[model samples]
Target: MSDEELSSYLPHQGDRIRLRVHVRKEEETPRTKKNKLLTVLQEKLEAARKKKTTSKEEHNLEDMRNPHRPFGNRNAAKQNRMIEIGWIHKSNQRSTQIRKNKGGGTRKTEIPRHATKVEIIQQAIGLFFPNGLSSKGPLTNFNFDLWDFADREIDANVTVADMYERTKLPILRFYLATSQKTNDIGNTTDA
Candidate 1:
């Protein structure tokens, strides 16, 4: 029988088509998949951006209706405080002395202003714990509770040592005498 006659007798149209053809199919690589994903993401992002721009007027109207939204001015107070603190200078010797008496230095001396923050902190730490950092004998225990109290009063999120560096507060130096003590005591004791 001819091929046509045989094909016509088949039950289904697909089964009648017996011719086979070979075609090369390319496999998708990771790089190609990644590029496709990136393109899709970019398209989605552009759509979102356009949507946001189109709705901006609506958002503006809402903001106008409720000018004093709690979320709108969340950082306003903190920003103002930061600005106020930034305006403060280390040259205010009288203020520094007062702060020093309170056990918190908030300014640096003119010469120490050029020093690094770490240096200032180390100096303050040395002054506060003269016997804690040394390698000698007869270590003396000093109370750091005053420094903590001063830090809280300053309310600048800065360490007592750092306050001394910035304000050149003489009170910090009063507590910073050089001692002939050893670190062994400090290492063994928990503060």
Candidate 2:
């Protein structure tokens, strides 16, 4: 009779369709590696400055301290060299990556860098686990073998189901268990 009334014909056929969805998007501050590192360094410098009783005096830490402590020869040039000036020196060990090979031996491996001047790995998120969701390795203290092996065939967004479809690991535990949620339905009126 009324517009709000549900009719039998309308119930059989779909009267109207309503789409509902909750969309969440996060806008991360796009920070460069150097920018983040420099900010940290600057903070450290500022804190050091604040702690010092001296007025506007930059702390020459190693310079003032008696320099002839170490076992190295007391050459004046090397004395100045101890105080690292502008840049930090990376290890010549070539990329901090080492792996064991077959035949009971070890081999050196290096991942390609984005640039000539080694960009500080400010964000190693996708670099390590592209899946966004961390694997069991990181949770435990176990070493992640993802980097050592070649890239996976599946996309970063691929889940357990996708992996199961591709290869092994069909981890289907809850079937009917998840069909309808089991709950002890309680109400204030019943009480």
- In model 2, what lDDT does residue 38 have? 92
* Candidate No. with top lDDT: 1
- Candidate 1 lands at a TM-score of 0.23
- Please give the distance, in angstroms, between residue 99's alpha carbon in candidate 2 and its true position after superposition: 66
**Runs off by more than 4 Å, candidate 1:** 1-35, 63-96, 100-191
lDDT of 2 by residue, 23-85 (tens): 111124436798789989999999887877453343345545756565433432231111100
Residue 24 deviation, candidate 2, in Å? 14
Best by TM-score, which number? 1
| Residue 141's lDDT in candidate 1 | 38
Q: Give the C-alpha lDDT of model 1.
A: 0.40
Candidate 1, poorest ten consecutive residues by summed lDDT: 80-89
Query: Model 2 residue 9 lDDT?
Result: 34
Q: Estimated TM-score per prediction?
A: 0.23, 0.14
